[model samples]
Target: MRRADEPDDRRTLERRALTEWPEQAGAQVRSVAVAGDRAEVTLTVNGHHDYWVYYRRGRVGREERVSGNGPTLGWEDPSAIGW
Candidate 1:
């Protein structure tokens, strides 16, 4: 389980890498949020609209996947999420 307030740099890096998988070619990660073993990443695949991605630790760091994908999220601006 992951704590909301506390953060794990390793987990974030792992999740970020997972987000960049070949299947997501042309997509760009804009933001990342980790809560426990679950992760949510915002991206712009088409370079226009935004998308939200969901991932969870599979078998304790054995794998990661994009479980959910949809329209832009209801949060801060997309550009503010990352570079």
Candidate 2:
């Protein structure tokens, strides 16, 4: 059976991003880029840009939110995160 953590495609990656980061559940998915087993998701919520990166193992390796309160989830370095 396919587990929720193992996102293998674009749709699954998007869903996993929301499930793993519930804070961005209502956020709009601005973009989703999949390469092999990895994926990078961009979301916008409350006028701020957020990022969610799914690694080769289908797990979310990094996440970052840019909101009024600042980074709330993961690494702050933009160079360290993303696709």
Candidate 3:
């Protein structure tokens, strides 16, 4: 019985860590929006085109583009939700 708006504890912590984009990583989050069970994020990165990321589960779910071309990496943690 998890509340819809309440992210998983571990996932929340991980997402918080991602709040600051790594200096080595070229990507920067431009916007984030959540509705029901889905989240949409827009990112802009050097050497890459602007892209949109969609999340279905929280932080542990795989991230993919709703539309556009970009490399997509799956979640490393299978048990966690939302990163």
Candidate 4:
């Protein structure tokens, strides 16, 4: 079984960025999780106070902020996240 905190495989990250999270270009993901086919992510940007839900891929996907809020979700190429 795979855990959410486990480092995402390069291919998984690439696929998610290209297909699932193309809209989250400039944001940085603080954490990511995958259960079965679903994915959940936590992200924050330079100007934002709170982290936001970045993306969820698969059934029952969801994104939510864990802290303060400021900036809206923005898109950046996955390469920028230093995957």
For each of the candidates, give the backbone clash count.
1, 0, 7, 6
On lDDT, the candidate that comes out on top is 1
> What ranges in model 3 sit over 4 Å off?
1-25, 58-67, 70-83
Off by over 4 Å in 4: 1-11, 14-26, 49-83
1-83 per-residue lDDT for model 4 (tens digits) = 14465454423543443343345455566655554433444455543633433333334433322223433322222333311
Ranking by TM-score: 1, 2, 3, 4
C-alpha RMSD values across all candidates: 9.0, 8.7, 9.0, 11.6
Total backbone clashes of model 2? 0
Candidate 3 per-residue C-alpha lDDT over 1-83 given as tens digits, one digit per residue, 9 for 90 to 100: 22324456335423542454666767665655554455555567564657655555546653442434452343223354444
Q: List the residue pairs that clash in candidate 4.
A: 23-75, 24-76, 25-75, 25-76, 26-75, 26-76
What lDDT is reached at residue 77 by model 4? 29
Range of the 10 consecutive residues with the lowest summed lDDT in candidate 2:
63-72
The TM-scores, one per candidate, come to 0.46, 0.45, 0.43, 0.35
Task: Please list the residue runs of candidate 1 whose C-alpha ends up more than 4 Å from where it truly belongs after superposition.
Answer: 1-25, 62-83
